[model samples]
Target: MSPQWFVVYCKSREESRAQRNLENQGVYSFFPKIHKERILRGKKKVVEEALFPSYLFVNISQKDEKFSAIRSTRGINSFVKFGMSIATIPDQQVKQLEQLCHVNNKLAINSDDAYKNGDKVEILSGPFKGITAIFDIEDGLERSMLLLKILNQDNNISFKNSALKKAES
Candidate 1:
C-alpha cells in the first residue's frame, strides 16, 4: 500500500483547481508550472502556465486512498487509464519532474531543446529590444550569440538567453 504517483486528467483549464481540491482531501499532488513569455495586446508579458495543461500528478496508495472521493472531486475528470487499469507512474520519474519544476521555475527563459542556430528570434529586452535576429546557442548555457542584420550586413552579437524570444512565423 505504498504511495505511488498517478496521472490525473483534469477538466479543461482546471488543473490548478483540481490540485487544490485533491490537496484539501489530504491527497498529495504535484502541479508543475512554468513562466511563459507571450505577446499580449501588442506588448510582451510573462505568465505562469501549467507545464502540462489538463494534467497533474497525484501520489496515492490505492489500498489506503479514497478513490470514490477523488473521482467525484470537482474540476477533476478522472485518472489516466489504459483499458480498465489506471496508470501508475514510477517514483523516480516523479522525482525527476519535481527537480525540473524547481529548476525551470527559476529560469526566465525556457530550457527546452527548441533553440538552434539560424532560427529566427526577437530580443525581448535590453538595447536590442524589438529587433529580430538569428539564434546561436553556445555551450548550452546562458551566454549565447545572435546574428543581426545591419545595413544589409549580418552582424554577430553576444546576448544572454533571457533577452531572446522566439519570433512568430
Candidate 2:
C-alpha cells in the first residue's frame, strides 16, 4: 500500500504527550524542532526543546485495521479536519520537512536577530518594496529579523536563510 500522510489533532497544548504515546504504540511519526532561547522562572536564560508548538505528522494506512488503533490512542484528540474528513497535508510541505530532517546541524527557527540591526535591505515578500529596513541580527545568528520602517513605526519581519535568497546590493 502507498504511504499516506495526515495531520493528527493533538490535545490543546498536549502535543508532546501525543508524540510519546504514538511512539510507544510503534506508529511512525515525525516532529521537527529548532533551538530557541527562552527565559525561565529562574530569570536565567536556557535553550529548551519546544515541540514546534502544536503539530505532528503521521504515516499510516487509512483503511487498515490499525487505523482504529490510532483513534483510540491517548493524547490524540482526532485527525485534522476539513468538513467531515481528515485533512491531507500537501506533498510540498512534507517534502520541505523531509529536507529539514535530512540535513545535519542546528535548525534556525525564529529571526529575533538574523541581521545587523541597522543594516539596510529590500523587502522580499510583502506590500512594501524598494524600501529599506533595519536588518536585526539575533545573538545566535540562527535567524534574522527585518525591521521595516513605516511612517514612525518599526514593523518586524523575520525570514529563514532559505526563504531569503540574499540581500540585493
Candidate 3:
C-alpha cells in the first residue's frame, strides 16, 4: 500500500528525536533540519535544529488504530486536524515551503508578510529570508537591517551589506 503523509505531534523542541523514533520503528518520516551558526556564552557554535517544532510528517498507511501505537511513543501528540476530521496537508504547501527554504535560506510563515512604506526591513541571506520582512530603503540591498525575533520575543536581526528586496505585497 502506498504510504500517505500524516502529521504527527511531537514534544516541544523534540522534533529531531521524534523523527528518529519513527524511523527506528520502520515508519518513514520527514523532519527538515537546518544547520546554523549560533553563539553560546560568547562562543560560536554550529548546531542542527529542527525547522519545525512539535511537529513532523510521517509516511504511513492510515490503518485502523495503528496511530494509537504511534501516539503512545515519546514526544508525540496527535495529527493536526479540524473538528471530527484530520486536516489534510496540501502538497503545494509542502513544496512551496521547501522552495522557500532553498530560495532564501529560512522558513517563512503562511501569513501575509507583504510589507509597506517605512516598514521595518531586514535582509536575511537570500530571497524571502527576512523573517518574512518587508520594507523599502534607498540602499536596501546594499545594507539590510533585519530584526530577528527569537524565543517568541522581538529582537533585532541586523544584516549589513546584504541583498535586500521588497517583501511581497
Candidate 4:
C-alpha cells in the first residue's frame, strides 16, 4: 500500500517535538505553523505558533512502516482515530494546507480577512475573557471595535486585535 496522511495527536504544546522525533525515526511529518504578531509587555513581537495545536500530520504506509514505532515516539500521544478506524487526511487537502502555509504563513495584523463587521467574536483575554461580543470594526492597526452587551445594553468597546478571536459557530 502507498503512504497515506494521518493525524497524530501529541502532548500539549509539543507538536514540534513530536515532528522532530518522527522525522528522526524516518517517518515523514508535517507540522503546520503560522506567524502571528502579538503584543508582549507593551511591545509588538512576531511569534510562530502551531496552526493546529497538539496535532500534526504524518505520512505512513501500513504495509511498510511500523505503527508501533510511531506510537512509541516521544511527544506522540496517539493516532487520531474513531472507534477502530484511524482517520486519514485526503492528499489534496494536505497539499492545499502546505500551499497556504508556504504562501502566507504570517498573519496580517491589519487585514480585514481576520474579521468582518457583525461577526461574533470572543474576548480571549483581559476582563472580558469568556465574554462573546459582536465585531464592529477595526479601530486601527492594533485595536478593534466590538459591540458588547452589558446589563442588556449594547455598548461599543475597543480592544487589541490580538485579544479577540472569532467565536466558534
Candidate 5:
C-alpha cells in the first residue's frame, strides 16, 4: 500500500515531542515551523514557532500495522478523525506547506512591509497616545516593541501593532 498523509493531534504544547517519538518509530512526519522576531529582556531575538500548534502530518499507509503503535506513541493524542474516518491531507497541499515553511524560515527578522529598526512611529491610541517613539522590533504577530524617550531615558515599551503608525516625516 502506498503511504498517504494523515494528521496527528498532539498533546498540548507537545508537538515537538510527538514528532520525535514518531521518528523513533520510523514514521515520517512533517512539523511545520515559522521564524518570528521577538523582544526578550530588551534584546531582539528570532524564534521558531509551530505554524500549526499541537498538530503534525505523518505519512503512513491506511492499512499499516504501525497504526496501533502510533496511537500509543508518547505525546500523541490521536489521529485527527471525522466521525469514523481518519483525516487525510492531499500530498500537494502538504508539499505547498513545506515550500511555504522553507521560505518563511529563510526570511529575515523584519520583512520589507514591516517597520525597520529606528523607524519613527507615533502611538495612535493608548495611555501613550500621540507619543513618538523609535521602532524596536516586532514583539509578536499583533504586538511590537518600541523605544520611548521618557525623562531622558529610553524605555522599551510594548504596544499593539494597531496602536502605532509610521510617523510622518
Candidate 6:
C-alpha cells in the first residue's frame, strides 16, 4: 500500500519541531504556515505562523509496521483518529490544500495605511481613470468609498482600494 496523508497532533507550539523531527527521520510531512501582518511595539511587521496550530500533516503507510515508530517521534503527541480508526487524508485534498496555501500564504491584514479621510486621490486604472476624488472611510477589506464631483453635485462611488492612489501632492 502507498503512503497516505494523516494529521499529527503536536504539543502546544511544537508544530515546527515535529516537522523537523519527521524530516530527520526521512518521513514526508507538511507544516503549512501563513504570513500575518501585525502591529507590535507600535510598528507594523509580518510574522509567519502555523496555519494549523499544534497540528501538522505526515504521510505514512498504515499497513507498514516498520513505520509505526512515528507515534514515539519527538514533539508529536499522536495521530488524529476517529474512534478506533486513524483518519486518512486523500492525496488530492492534500495537493489542493498545498496549492491553496501556496497561493494565499502571505496575507496582509491592516497592512496598508495609505488612505485617510478627505485625502485627494486619482483613480489609477479604471473607467474613472484620471478622475480626482476624496478618499472616504474604507468600506471593507477590498472596497472603499470615494467622493467624486459630477455635474456640480457630490457623488459617492464605491471602488476597490487598489483603484485609487494619492493624487500627486
lDDT of 5 by residue, 10-116 (tens): 99999999999999988999999998877777655778999999999999997888877887899998999999999999999999999999987887555566789
Model 1 agreement with the true structure over 100-168: per-residue lDDT tens digits: 878877786654745777889989988889999988655234556788998999988888878877899
> In what order do the candidates fall by TM-score, top score first?
6, 5, 1, 4, 2, 3
Query: In candidate 2, residue 164 scores what lDDT?
Result: 41
- Of 1 and 3, which scores higher on TM-score? 1
Instruction: Report the candidate with higher lDDT, 3 versus 5.
Output: 5
Error of 3 at 56 (Å): 0.6
lDDT of 3 by residue, 18-52 (tens): 77777777776777666565667654445666677
lDDT of 6 at 12: 95
Cα lDDT tens digits for candidate 2, 53-101: 5677888778767677876778777787899988777668887876765
Better of 5 and 6 by TM-score: 6
Q: Rate the local accuracy (lDDT) of all candidates.
A: 0.83, 0.65, 0.61, 0.87, 0.90, 0.83
> How does model 2 fare in lDDT?
0.65
The clash tally of candidate 1 reads 0
Consecutive 10-residue window with the lowest summed lDDT within model 6: 105-114
**Minimal lDDT window, size 10, model 3:** 134-143
lDDT of 4 by residue, 1-169 (tens): 8999999899999888888888888889999987777777754566788899999999899776566688889999999999999999999999999988876764443365578889999999999999999999777568999999999999999999899888999
Scored by lDDT, model 3 comes in at 0.61
Model 3 residue runs over 4 Å out of place are 64-66, 91-169
User: Across residues 10-89, which tens digit of lDDT does each residue of candidate 6 receive?
Assistant: 99998888888889888899888777756577544577888889988898787877368788888999889999888888
- Superposed Cα deviation of residue 25, candidate 5 (Å): 0.7
Off by over 4 Å in 6: 106-163, 166-169
> How big is the positional error of residue 92 in model 6, measured in Å on the Cα after superposition?
0.9
